[model samples]
Target: MIKYLLNQSLLSMKKRYDYDVTYMQDILRTDLGAFMKFMAFQTMSTHKGNLPVEALYAARIRAIIWDDCGPCTQLIVNMAVEANVDSVLVKAIVDRDLEKLPSAISLVVRFTELVLAHNPEADELRQQIIELWGEKGLITIAYGICSTRVYPALKYTLGHGKTCSRVVLNDEPVVPKKNPQLVGSHHD
Candidate 1:
């Protein structure tokens, strides 16, 4: 029901949500666990303002997605590791002088905790992170800022401490199949 409702909401949002349904279904057939994680991660990122750096965190975090659990785990791990490297080192890998990854990743992990735990964790996490990240990293953050609820306020919100982007539902969740009684009631 939640999945259907969210899909309907996306449909109403002017063809902006363009996740490939068939591809997602295929993944659902193959490995449901990873699909659930990906879906949960995206869903948690969308509605919750608790996700730190709220906007940029989701954008950077979603840079990679895969069909396989192993690959998906590695992709998320890579995102985590990228957050720990120096810009010069990262620049060597991607041929760009990007310095935002470290801060973005750090905040994202912190945001993850905020989503799972709550405000107390967020406060402690924020305090510990105050000196590590600065204004530029915050400014460069762009993805998750304009989440689903905020989508309706784009024209007014844009350039006013808000962001605008395509909103995609994570993936359709799988309903476990229930076993059927053998045509009629069976005697024990």
Candidate 2:
């Protein structure tokens, strides 16, 4: 229902931004006002930065996971690619293989996770980030992580939240088949 409304809004905005909106249809359908606000903020954030784009993206990605926003998560995969985050790193993140990423990025992911979870270890993680990236860097990371968390919360509040089912390696999510025979592994 809301998805349908958001799609209508996107159709109107399509001329404004030259890109496919199909991946983001769910978000559009949920809340057009919030969607527009996010698009504006995303454009602004990407244009100016204290932290490296990849780090910002990593933080946002972690927040998206914390949000468990399926649509938002999938959308960020494309956004990260546009931001020049290496495809391999993005794949590692989607695959839950943080070990494959550089220590700095992986640390950012972990720290974001702790912060979102309100874990006591967040302070220690903050210190580590400060040592690695300095005061400005820490601030940049905080800004990115903090700012990125709002949308997902809003989505959840609106009851549009969804767990991501796709493991993004490229353009599409790898959705497993329900049938054991079709999926290649039988359940006991």
Highest TM-score model number: 2
Clashing pairs in 2: 2-29, 3-29, 6-28
lDDT of each residue in 120-141, candidate 2, tens digit only: 7779889988898788888777
- The per-candidate count of clashes, in order, stands at 2, 3
Worst 10 residues of 1 by lDDT: 174-183
Q: State the C-alpha lDDT per candidate.
A: 0.35, 0.65
Prediction 1 TM-score vs. true: 0.25
lDDT of 1 at 20: 24
TM-score of each predicted structure versus truth: 0.25, 0.65
Question: Can you write out model 1's per-residue Cα lDDT over 51-132, one digit (the tens) per residue?
Answer: 3432343333332210111222233223434445432332222211124445545454444334323235556655544444
